[model samples]
Target: MRVVHRLFEMLIPRRPVSHQAKDRDNLQDWKNYVYGRARSAWARGLPLYGSSFRFTIVYLCGDSPADIDNIIKPIQDALVGVVFSDDSLVSDVDSHRRFISDGIDLTNLPALLIEGALSGEECVYVAVDSAGPLGSYL
Candidate 1:
């Protein structure tokens, strides 16, 4: 009842949030944004509960000094039911949040958003692969 081989990647044109005071009120908005954007962009009929998947993510935090770990859970939770059946199925993972000026060239990444990159907008880039190549994603 799960996908054997698959890849789901998306670029959420928004900012990453955390449990910090400044982000608390916006958590709901953040979740809603991610879910709606991802769902609309998904071409597949429905999300499958994969046996296990490698989740790779890189979020642009614009200017805030948000903790990467704190930013990760909300993003993962947002993808639930949209990208996968549950976040527990995410066995392998690589995630990070940084400023747009981090100087990382993400052009080679399949999920890179050219508009976001060119406009220097904050966004969350995610890739879920059932093939399990966590290192390659990093």
Candidate 2:
């Protein structure tokens, strides 16, 4: 079974927030906000399926510098119960960082391609694919 799930511009943290003395409050706030958004998005989307799957996270940036690693953690954590039963079901994971510049036609960009682009505004895409136990290797 193959399943693809997506959460639009729901906030994703670049990294797990550190609970250092100075940044505790801010970090907690960030964690709360991101986690809440992810949960809400997952709750509203299609139900999860598949015991093992490949997950892809595409980050759309708007003229800002961000670490891909930092952005994926909150998402992975938040999806634990909502998307899959647990994060371990995500056997293979990949991430893509994209920069959308002004005046660049979005229609022709290969990386920006999505399954249903014509229906709504562009946002982050999370795709999960389960290749049926060994996929093509068997």
Candidate 3:
């Protein structure tokens, strides 16, 4: 898949919230936190990306072993009306969880993730790219 342009990219300096958060209060807090961070980074109420997009989420952590799959939806839903208009617009997605302390193979990882691990912060690296093929035809 071709990435036309990066619509949004940020190394969120916090652990990603997993969809498995069954506690209502905790889930609400996570949603609020995501909204606050995303809203602040992006304009509060700007036009959302409407075309096909790709999401690449990397969870860099030392211990919290949440399923990578479970974490994706919450983050994606949290970005609704902020990053992209709808989930249906997502053409591709890549999600991964990597441990920092363990000798992670640095070859494939991006530089920022290495830096984050070195900094000792369990954070989420999220990037959204515009998928060119379908969008280009329009």
TM-score for each predicted model, relative to the true structure: 0.78, 0.55, 0.79
Root-mean-square deviation (CA) per prediction? 4.8, 6.5, 4.1
> In terms of TM-score, how similar is model 1 to the real structure?
0.78
- lDDT tens digits, residue span 1-138, model 1: 333343777787776778553656688888888888879867776776758888777777667656777777887888888878898998887786667787657655453555456658887778787745555446
- The CA lDDT of each predicted structure is 0.73, 0.53, 0.74
Better of 2 and 3 by lDDT: 3
| CA lDDT, candidate 1, residue 26 | 86
Index of the highest-lDDT prediction: 3
> Against the true structure, whose TM-score is highest?
3
Candidate 2 lDDT, 1-138, residue by residue in tens: 423334332434332343332565766675576557666656446545556766677665555535666656555665666666677777777777665443234564333344323223334555555634555534
Models sorted by TM-score, best on top? 3, 1, 2
The model with the greater TM-score, 1 or 3, is 3
Clashes of 3: 0
Cα error, candidate 3, residue 43 (Å): 5.4
